[model samples]
Target: MDEKTLTISVEPLEDVKRRMLASLRGAADATARHTFASAELMSRTLTPARWNILEAMTGAGEIGIRELARRLGRDVKAVHTDMAALVTAGLVERTAAGKYLFPYDRVRVHFEFGAPAMAA
Candidate 1:
């Protein structure tokens, strides 16, 4: 629950692709399929750096550009670039308060799988 204090190691690019492929192939059933589909779609829309910004912004709610940079362990200018990219992609928005936030309308990716007997 304490997302701020949580630190996750970035997996290698090969590992990321492998995991994604595995997630795609090993989907348990329909619901799981859809969930993984959403993750994949989201992941594709993100650059590695942009994904970091999303994780940080998602965890912390609204934040300033400086703080986003600090959380990402990058300098201001580098994060400035990431922010611009995310903003352009519509994954994040800069508010009137001069802080960045994920939009209230969260994204959903829909895919139906399997048959009537089970959703998954």
Candidate 2:
């Protein structure tokens, strides 16, 4: 089977807008990307718990919240809360059957910090 990949990135809002415009114009690449306004926001959204959830769900197929919690050895309520945040971030999806899924087989993160401007 072909691999599905998702890219997570910290990008300025303008950059995200440009990419969206490109997509509307059919000029964007096929890879799926989820962009955060800043590294801080990305870190806040993808916490360690959420990251663990993602790791557990990767290629694991649709799973109920209770089963997922059991697999991760976490409380169901806590897992559910993390799952809700992930779903809001578009990193996770809730199926019609009320199961959760991380559709991508792989995840790639891309970001960089530019050097500060030199003072005169």
Candidate 3:
């Protein structure tokens, strides 16, 4: 089976708008992309605990929150809270059966900082 990939990036809103317009114009690629408005936002959303959750879920198939918590050795309530945040961020999905899934086999993060602007 082919490996599914999710691309995460920090970008300005204008760049996101341009990309959306391009996609509407049929210039879209097959890969899934998630863009954050800024690095700080991305950092805040994808915290270390959340990253651990993603790592555990990747390619793990649909699992109940309790099982996921057991696997992570975390409290069910904490896991559920993180899962809710992840679902809201579109990084995870909730099945009809109420299980959680992170469908991608791989995650690629891409972002860069340009040189600071010089004042005249």
Candidate that scores best on lDDT = 3
What would the per-residue lDDT of candidate 1 be over residues 1-120, giving only the tens digit for each residue? 322232222334575477578778984322211122244554665668876676667545788989878777899998888788777755567889988886332233343345558566
Please estimate how well model 2 matches the true structure, expressed as its whole-model Cα lDDT.
0.92
lDDT of 3: 0.94
Tens digits of per-residue lDDT, candidate 2, 6-71, equal: 899999999988988999998968998888899999999999999889989988999999999999
Q: What 10-residue stretch in candidate 2 is worst by lDDT?
A: 28-37
Candidate numbers sorted by TM-score from highest down: 3, 2, 1
lDDT of candidates 1 onward, in order? 0.61, 0.92, 0.94
Q: What is the lDDT of residue 88 in candidate 1?
A: 77
Supply candidate 3's per-residue lDDT for 69.
Answer: 97
Pairs of residues at least 3 apart in sequence or in different chains that clash in candidate 1: none
Instruction: Estimate TM-scores for all models.
Output: 0.49, 0.91, 0.93
Following a full C-alpha superposition, what root-mean-square deviation does model 1 have from the true structure? 12.7
- Which candidate achieves the best TM-score against the true structure? 3
Worst 10 residues of 3 by lDDT: 28-37
